[model samples]
Target: MATNLLKLNNIKTELMVVASPSQSKEVGDVLLNVDGCTIRPSQEVRNLGVILDCNLSLQAHISSTTKSAFFHLTNICRLRPSLSDPVAETLIHAFITSHLDYCNGVLYGLPNKALDRLQRVQNSATRILTNTKRWQHITPTLKHLHWLPVKSRITYKILLLTYKSLHTLAPQYLSDLIQQHSQPRSLRSSDKNQLVTPRSRLRTFGDRAFCVAAPTLWNSLPLHIRQAPTLETQAQMEHDPPGSLTLQLQGMRLSTSNKSVEGYTYNSFTLQLEGLNVSQESTYPVFLFILFSYLFIIVANLGLAVLVFVDKSLHQPMYLLFCNLSANDILGNSIMLPRLLIDMLRLPSERLISYYECVVQAFTSHMFGTTSHTVLMIMAFDRYVAICNPLRYAVIMTNRMLITLTVSAWGVPLVLVGILLGLTIRLNRCRTLMKSPYCDNAALFNLSCESVFINNIYGLTFTVVLFTASIGSMVLTYTKITVVCLTSKNKSLNSKALKTCSTHLVVYLIMLFSGMAIITLHRFPQYSDSRKLASVLYHIIPSSLNPIIYGLQSKEIQNFLSKLFKSNKVLASK
Candidate 1:
């Protein structure tokens, strides 16, 4: 009987072997594969509802022969065919996990409220599982088990056994804490007020639960399970704490390592968890640049507006075009820059934007952008109209015409790309971890769970059309100016015309090409960094540079700015 008992229960091993009658004639079966745990074929593993056919008394844990264990080792083996064997790893997972729950009363090596919650939940679950008839098909008959809690003595002993299991699982933490428990250092008198914990809305459990359980659970917990009292004297008030119980169970130890973005592999008494591997891609600076740069242009344009209004001499077609171009650039940045910053700021690289946001950006960015683009085209046309036909320019490009034109620009984008925002394509489910600070269109598209075939297609089409139109109009407009200058009879007018057209061409190329190039690079995975850098140049940096470039290059604008600053400084000093 002693030999039989020893063979029947090897508590030290992580693998729990149970026996039952085999469903088929096969004597030996492949129970599990540890890696990639997948079950064996249904009929093959079940062998027709039987498990332990050999009938070894120790192997009774697997056998459904006696109405006890229905989910035997055999069924598990078939269910989880793994490199590590489904039968073994699952049993291991459950055993350690369940035991940890019971012992969590340990916090910082002391039995505390956290551990108490675990114990309470465990006891309640065990009570429900034990008392209900539904679980009986699994456990041995309640009366026949030697360790079954019987008298008060048996109950107390079982309680000790549970404490021992907890200590082994979470050795680093305390079962509960005292003032000197975790904080080994001493506190000064002035720091007393700082020592008190805050009363917060976030904590789930009441303070009393932890406060009460702290001291009680810690001292009573046993270090080892083998020393736990048997069913006979378990009820007796032992009074003394059990610190050194023998550990007979052999299994992988646990860890509380708080590393992020990594997985774990376990070994005996030691666990190895891989650390996070960061990606090489970087693009956040570009978004930031876009945001700040456009803001500066807005400020500079407003300043220029104040200067123009204050000085009647400065109010002319050229200055008006300058104001319009600044506005276009400001509006252009507004389309995509702010939201890109917001997305980067709010979530990690992995979290995808809502379908609507992606569509909205794709569409409205185009809207504000198309408006800006058309406005840019108008700016070029205005310059042409002014230099070529200065006398008729006022009548031709009146304020009303400009207003109607700006409205047209806004409306065209609203109508065409409007559908992009309302629709959501369930593309690839993005990893919640954000790669960049913002949720740019490309980032969201990448994170999608479904196919982005349409998004990409429409995106490409819009890019080519809008980009080509804006650049084409600006280039063609400037080319006409160059031709007019070469052929014209007046040297003074031609010189001014050449200078103005050339300046606009420089600004136009910088604005259009840089932004378009960055956006295009997003399609290629390998060039993401380069794309981000380009976006920075397009978004914030260019906006900042725009005012400076025009202010420095144009003699009329520089003289105007110098007088305006002198006026401001004089006003401030007064």
Candidate 2:
């Protein structure tokens, strides 16, 4: 070995051997002779800043780290009085904490007593930086500074390497050690990004092997986090400091708890939205078109609604319901479009919304949809009373009755959707990416890592009840109107009733078919492209068409619009 080293221009003095724990006792008294060079068996070897003992206990490494850390901490404490807080923190981190974290992955699975020595070093460094008294607790200070405990720091290092290995960003040796768990047949967890944990015979030694320990920790993370597309995204999902990853090991639950091992709190989550799959060239054109559609929806719906509010002669039951429908159109599109427009200008990766904003958007969306259907149902009833019981219509649909119905139309949806969003807020969300153009109840609740069975049941039940009540009431009222029309002897009454009901019926059918198409397209992934288009259209089309249908088809509204326009022309001429 010496002669070979000489041939390669390397010195033989660099060669050292620390025997395995099993052979340590026998080799402790023995010396090695290779190619006329005499070498002694070392009890501990220092390589690349880590001290590895014959038994591989890592005690020497930990002791060296803590000693060096305390040495730096002592020096920093002496100058801490002169240094500002930020400068002091920088010095401490540079001198003390960095030493503790150097190559700390090899210290995983050590006994608590062994790890606590290094923990004290960190705790002291934190205290000196913050000028915190020794009698005070340290956990809060560590959390405030976003520092992980020594044990968690060790786990973080290992898991980070594991993540890199799985993503092919680590060394080939590490990538080779990681094996993805696979099955011959599909299972419930088939889509979960799980790794195969190799079997280990000994708890102390075998369990610490990279192949065993890496998979064991990797599989414990939530499925959504494990499946994050990028390392930055995974770090964001964990809600740790910029470079650290939080885990639910040793009583921690992804920073959800305030106990030990819990390093940070999640103040808010940023969600990623998947908008239309437009090419770079088409993005601006698509955005402009969507902007035009949204502006039109606002102007048309609000214009019609304002016209109804201003014109006292058009204050009858059917026109009042038309006004309600117009308001709903403006609201529904507003809930979806403004944020969507802003997101469209951003890159796909930059399309982000806060957790609270998402919940509000979702709640308003449900309210807008449900209230629109309710108003349509109410319109059918209004037509039924007008055509079938014209004499009693004035008496039945009084001012008080109109107020009550309008209030119910808006208030009931608010309460129901409030309850739905309340359920969603209580869930602990593990995923931050939403595969939708905008926030909705379905998309928001699906981000939670836990089972949303209850949310699904309640949402489905609310939808079913709302649809049943709206559709049933409309069908029964229209059926009665049909029977009355066919049997009535008055041609004038028949013609007026058909004209009035046609506009409402057309608007209702458009909304119903568009909604149904969106729901149907979601069930088939093959129709994802179509689903995105349909979802966008579902919000904008009904809103845009309702005002046009009412303005053109309803004689009363048309006459009112004509008079308003003529008066405007007369004033302009004057």
Candidate 3:
């Protein structure tokens, strides 16, 4: 009788049971006519919702589960036209992926062909969501959705399970399975904190077993990633380190070999030129416009720089700062505008640029742009000394001090952008269509396949600190100058002070507003069309207008130009 029996194990839960044809004997015959128990040979048996088969490979269960999932997915796809993306994603997850994920820990060391079968299901699922054609690229789509690949996902789950086991006591069996190594090594991190996976002789069982697979996955994790507070955080930890963007090409196991461009093997990254949106009809006009603007930027900024350098009488803290601004304008424009003009005129088929070149352009643009911020802060400090304490101005901002400030103006931006570029060059850029006239750092960053949180954090920190210091110093200096002007009894002195400060104020305002507009547009993708326009204006307009604004308004520049033009007229008459 089955009533008082020990371990009556073979139970059936579904119809259409499968067994070997040679062993299709009746239950009563096999049981030797046991009194109270009977078996249903036609019914299927399940353990933990996973059907067990005569073969121990788990092949039949995986096959049946996959088929059931696809059958349900095919029905769901028919409702695609009426389904929103979120709803469709929900349905796919509920019906298809849930089946794939269920008891997937048992699939740790499955054959490649078996894993490939499941991978095809995931690829199809992603394709369905994006409505991508069969032949179109899928890697970028997966990256955009932040979905880890099949192999990585398996590793992620295993490592996450290990993390939980280490941190929590609820899973006593899992915790006991992991044994920390007792022996220590000489290496820095080899303090015996690592879990030792017990080796097994049976390869099939060993590879699929939890003890072996879990420690292998756990040991691969960096200490920081392994120390994650929760399973969700552990799941979110990236497969590679912060500056490991380029390394992920090989690390991801997505491809066997890297693609070659111009005889050099590089991670494929194409930068799109977004700001050159002018039509064929308007090409020459735009070309001429940019050409003339560059010419004026060059002539104006260089002319001011030359004037400040050549004229001994005009050499002072103020004009030296102005010279630095002119020089920075030259540097910033030279980096971006030439490439932009070339790109704008290039044939549509020949528009592709080297990935390294794009990175260089982004670095230089940010370097000079940020240096301009630093120089302006120095200029503000100079103004504060001149206006607030004219008697001590020379002593406080001596020649040596000005030299140090100039060096800092150039040096500080280099350091900040060096860190940024160092991080940037390591990223795996998947998309190449640059969305601006030139390779903007922001657009370049957006194209990366790996986690750019470190890049983003550093950028945010630099911007906040630079802008805060620049704006705060300018406001404080201007406030003090205004108070001094109000308290002064001499109308002539106040008038002169206002005139001296007005040109600098006008230049600062123009640069400040243009910079703010460009940053705002950059931060918001919804302003895409406007961002392109703003980028062009930010790069060209400011460089073009800075010299014009200073040349037209500054008495020193105006006087120098007048004298030079008179000398030219005298020479022409001769």
lDDT of each: 0.46, 0.79, 0.71
For TM-score, candidate 1 versus 3, the one ahead is 3
In order of lDDT, best first, we have: 2, 3, 1
Lowest-sum lDDT 10-residue window in model 2:
259-268
Write model 2 residue lDDT over 161-213, tens digit each, in one string.
99999889999999999899888999987889899988997777778888999
Misplaced by over 4 Å in model 2 are 1-268, 568-574
Ranking by TM-score: 2, 3, 1
Per-residue error (Å), model 2, residue 561: 2.7
Local error of candidate 1 at 230, Å?
38
**What 10-residue stretch in candidate 3 is worst by lDDT?**
256-265
Q: Clashes in candidate 3: how many?
A: 11
Error of 3 at 77 (Å): 38
Q: Candidate 3: lDDT over CA atoms? A: 0.71
Distance (Å) between predicted and true CA of 60, model 2? 30
Can you write out model 1's per-residue Cα lDDT over 262-363, one digit (the tens) per residue?
Answer: 111100111111111224254355445556665776787677666666777767656665665566566656666665555444433233444454444455
Name the better of 1 and 2 by lDDT. Answer: 2
